[model samples]
Target: LRKSELKGLEIPGKLERLIATFFADDTTVYLSENDDFNDLQKILDDWCLASGAKFNIGKTEIIPIGSPEYRDLLRQTRFLNSVDGPKIPEHIRIAQEGDAIRSLGALIGNNICQVEPWTKVLERIDQSLDQWARSKPTMEGRRLIISMIVGGMTQYLTKVQGMPKEVEEKLTRRIKRFLWDEKTHVRINKETV
Candidate 1:
């Protein structure tokens, strides 16, 4: 509940002390090496016991964040990586670099500009286009369809996290090609719907 000064946690290149993120039943706790995991788990277990909810250790993971070199160091020292290192709970594994962890609906990994995050949305867009391809809707109908596709950026799946420029262009090209029923998607110019 209280934000304590995050000490001994050398995760981010630039840090923001300690913080806990809660989304409904799921909880993410950020801590440093100096923190006592046993005590923390006990508190969480107590909370879970009182709340009639079970702590799902199977879904728990240790996500290492920082510069690549710093993350490597954290990985090297992980209890899994080093038997002599501090022991972690069974079923909990440290995430490797470039691993995409699906939190809520977002695919998050080490790279911020990665296209992976938009893969699902792109799939949905493609499906919509495929379904609409057979229809002989008017030009205005195509424009509305394109508008819905664009609106996905603000939708819950994406949540306004801007995608890579390449992805934006890919979406534009595909939708435009579908609008004009053209074979070469890239050939659809901006002036043509």
Candidate 2:
């Protein structure tokens, strides 16, 4: 509601000009308190089309206006607001953890260290790491571990099969879940598909 908070709104076109000229001094600029998602989305889309700025689709979220989860999620990540564009899932397209896990999978398969499928995967991983570094860089000692959840099938195929009983037992102990956690990335099994 504050003047500084206006920077977060996605009011596009002449509406933005109107806001700046007349309501710039006003704390609250409301059209209708009962605006629906489609209505708000229309306003946002118009704003983005008029403005040259690109919205970071990976960093945006849409939540029920009054829900506690909405507020909590927003509070946790500031970029969740001001998302007035198309949504892109972060795991496949943006998350560094996804890239890291994919690279490790290649390494385990002995596909890395050479230039095959690993080359493409490595290139993507390099880009993801570079982006993450640019956003929130840290030294090795201070970096946080990104947990990339794997499916039971991938685990069974990668870690269980073709391994000694002792090693398989050790790996089973390390995995906390039997099911895969879903994300935006795709899991490929070349032999099957």
Candidate 3:
């Protein structure tokens, strides 16, 4: 793999030296060992000079990852606790436990937001079904609608990971309900529906 010029995050076993994703380098992520910010600051400063852009400190988030014990160790880092070290601006403080960080349109880290992706998919499906219910479309039309809309949802949402069994069942139930246009189960044959 090509080495990143903006090296920071350390990959175990020297696999890679940096972690980064770029859209013309507008946003970059660097991992500092513990809470050291001096290296990151210098890196950003260099990038700004080269690109003629300013780093936005206010929009920055410092999501702390690792076990609670690891976090405790991070808190005790000399740079983190130091009054003499280069100061981390107040708005760019490390995330507390239970805080969720949204990355690439997905909420991750601690808390209920971990389930946000599926919740949103479920909500969108319900809303769309409710609105489309008014049209009273033909069975073929409904089948087409589900294939076009709900089919994509199922494919995208379940692509990378297995969902909770209950959630999977609920999604199947919702689609089944929509297909039959029934509020309750009618005991119809599975293939017939």
Which candidate should be chosen as best, given lDDT against the real structure?
1
Candidate 1 total steric clashes? 0
The residue-by-residue lDDT of candidate 1 on 1-193, one tens digit each, is: 2343334344467555545767897777776555555656677787788999888878887776656775677576654223344556656777787787777667666755477778877888888877876787777887887787656543675453556787879887887687777755555466963
Clash pairs, candidate 3, are none
Q: Looking at model 2, report the run of 10 residues with the lowest lDDT sum.
A: 92-101
| Model 1 spans > 4 angstroms off | 1-18, 79-86, 157-161, 183-193
Best of the two (1, 3) by TM-score: 1
* Global lDDT of each candidate: 0.67, 0.34, 0.65
Best by TM-score: 1
TM accuracy, model 3: 0.75
Model 2 per-residue lDDT tens digits across residues 10-43: 4456344222222232222232212233443455
What overall lDDT, based on C-alpha atoms, would model 1 receive against the true structure? 0.67
Candidate 1: clashing pairs of residues:
none
TM-scores of the models, in the order given: 0.76, 0.19, 0.75
- Candidate 1 vs candidate 3: which has greater lDDT? 1
